[model samples]
Target: MMWKIQLFKLNFDHRERDAVLETVDSGWLTMGERILGFEAAFGDYLGHGARCTAVSNGTAALHMALLALDVGQGDEVIIPALTFVADANAVRMVGARPVLADCASRSDWNVSAESIARKITPRTKAVIVVHYAGFPCDMPAIAALCRERGLKLVEDVAHAPGASIAGQMCGTFGDVGCFSFFSNKNLSIGEGGMVVACDGNLSQRLRYLRSHGMTTLTLDRHKGRAATYDVAEPGLNYRMDEIRAAIGLVQLDKLPAGNLRRKELTERYRRNLAGSPLQMPFDNLSADVVSAYHILPVLLPQACDRMGVIEMLKTAGVQSSIHYLPFSGFTAYREYFTAQDAPLAEEICSRELTMPLYPTMSDREVDLVTGALLGAVA
Candidate 1:
């Protein structure tokens, strides 16, 4: 089927094409100079002496973060009920139990420190916070809470790259900050991720865990920096190759402008959807935070039929999506992870609708989707 607007359109152009071709032509493909360059560029963007470890994907980043923190069996990691299932999966991959926490409120999709506190147990070893929809979570308070409780904090920053709170980047506030450069993220590199640490030692641990726990990297040996290598520990081969790293470098260069455009389009949608029955999450966010506006998800009225509304939009040549359904709603996770009463996340699941949003999207398209949503709800 065809649609007039897509839920997300790639911002690729000649630059992306040239990047891939150039990387292929270089003949140094496996996590070479390009990976180092991408990591360095990302660290510079998030300043404050941060370092990044490029990984295979966001889930790999999460897995490595957990392994670096030594979160294994007999430990519990708290994660947001509203985020993608990868968070819970990553926890499980490290042999840790995942405690699902509810969002702060109906208007706020981010999991709050209060909600997280409720899920804490004697075995809780870490807290993973998702900056849902590119909105910054109350990290300052969450970080403080984690510190007081002696729990490691990992920032699941897949939806947010340039997002900041009180003049600081979102990923820098936690023990391990994980980011995704998936096809639809604020910064697209098809399939890649980066992990940043609050300090140097943790960052080194992440890098070691990214490869097969080798003392010296293949790149180091290739550049004559090391004669031979030793297995420091058993690690996964979660290294990002040169092609994605090359593309990531280009995407990093374009992120600020792309985020700014998304902010503009998000405001345009808000203005156009004003007074509509649907409610936009983070509508009343504080002035100190800046959003990456990665997605345009809104909640429909309870009385509105979600599938019917989707069909209406489809007939009108508009594309729509759902951010996620609660993990407990799935059959695979039902027995492994017990379901708790998270009214906010459940309510969001029943009515969440994502409208078309992307950097290349125009104001007219925002108006078209908002108008279509109003009509569909009506």
Candidate 2:
């Protein structure tokens, strides 16, 4: 059988179209009812009574969160070297220095709390923790550390939309939890994001910042009872469109079912790959940590070349990818941290390979991928 599986694919059906059409027929296209609805629903999902502010993308959400916290020049933000470059780039955008920290081997792909402690300086204003590949980081420990040091905590929850640690939702654990609803995320809106804030004051500030620092959003000003507005502060155009928000609302409804399917598929992948040399992601230390299984990443033994394995898998029609290259390894970050400082990140990057795992993937597809992986390693 000829297989044409992809690394990731968006799951869209008539539900998304109906939602979008409803917004279009209403003749309101910008941020409006759909956006507010999604924000409220997302807050309810997180269980923290947090205020959610929708934005254009995850990067914008991160940027706005940092700005809301007054993080800027002369400030330092600690982040895991294992995360995507966007995590660090957001810090740089705010004129704050991104202090890269190493991750722990035993804890999967999360930055070590000890490593974070080592890098903290008096200039450290915040710590950004990434829940890599849907695996929840040690948030309680990291949160405690931040509280002890008087540092704000920002969560890069791009890959962990439905994840929780110790019964606490991923986004609620931190002061500001940033999420991406990109096409590939667990719950997607094509190109949208949301920031959940613990503080009402901070949430209000973010609401203004996402709408070009306006005292009120376009919906607020034009829809009802508003005629004039003022620019409270300089902000960016990061508002989420009604169309995307409409799709997101539908996607949100299906998230629970989709996540359950992902979990089942993940268990099957683990069972099929058992007794093989490939290293699977570790189970959460606590029962409360429920992952949505965004990607099924396996660590190949050092004896096998990572890129070589990826190429071989491609030849076999099994799509594969690296979850991320260490942020510190990128040329842009080289100016800040040396390559030698992130040894764990380097090792993980060299061995990491993300295999296909989506709700649409079939049993045959999973078998083909595992078979190809086994052959490549052997």
Candidate 3:
């Protein structure tokens, strides 16, 4: 028998197709009712003083957030060394420099607040904290640090849509929270994103920035007597389409249930691997954090060679991957920072392996993956 499993997959059914068809039949295919509905629903879901604006994708959302903050040229934004390059790239897009920081060992691959505090300088304008793999970072400490130093706190919530720390949503605690609705994300729209901010002024500015700096969006333009518009500032076209927003609304409806299932599966993996040489990702109970359980990452012991185990798992028909390899290792950032300066991040990157944990995965698939992992280690 052949074994088949994917690292990531979208769970769309008849309901999604029906919603998309409904959107198509409505005749208005651009940003309109569907986008408004998604924004409202997402704001409610996050449970912060959150006001949401749907965008084209997560990267665009981040870019707009930085732009809205006036973070450009000669400013520095602090970010973790162990995250998707997009987090840092968003800073560069606005002509700002990205300062890399180290992650904490106890928090399981998340940036440390202490490290963030240490990296802050007079030129520091913002701190971008990523909730790595759905694990919420130390928000209280980070938020306090930002407040004290007067630095903008931006959250990269691409991996954690509905995640919370101490009963508060991840995105709400920061100055601006950005989410991804990529097909592989917890709340996917095939491809879309949103920004949540508590500030009304910032929200309005974001609206202007996402739609070509137009005074009104296309939806608003088609509805009223106004025939003329004005561009207040230079902006990018980052508006979300009605089709993607329709899919997003349906996916949002299913998120809570999907998150519960993911949690159950993660707990099962933890129990099954209790005594193994592999170290499961750590959870901080003190913070009362609950992950969306987007991915199950395990760290092999320092003695074990990570790439060798990945190849071994591949031979057994099981797929394994590394979450990141340190942003400094990438050529684009090498001039600003170096791998040698971030030994902890490099070490974590070398030993970390992410196993499959999608909602559609079965018990047998889990068993096969665990067995293969065990064999690789042995």
Candidate that scores best on TM-score: 1
Ranking by TM-score: 1, 2, 3
Q: Name model 3 segments beyond 4 Å from true.
A: 1-3
lDDT at position 167, candidate 3: 85
Q: Candidate 1: global Cα-lDDT?
A: 0.91
Each prediction's TM-score versus the true structure:
0.98, 0.96, 0.96
Location of the lowest summed lDDT over 10 successive residues in candidate 1? 335-344
Clashing pairs in 2: none
Score candidate 3 by TM-score against the native: 0.96
* Model 1 agreement with the true structure over 147-215: per-residue lDDT tens digits: 999999999999999999988998999999999999999899899999999688888888788888888
Worst 10 residues of 2 by lDDT: 280-289
State the local distance difference test value for candidate 2. Answer: 0.87
The global C-alpha lDDT for each of the candidates, from Candidate 1 onward, is 0.91, 0.87, 0.86
Candidate whose lDDT is highest: 1
What is candidate 3's local distance difference test score?
A: 0.86
lDDT for 290 (candidate 3) = 79
Off by over 4 Å in 1: 336-340
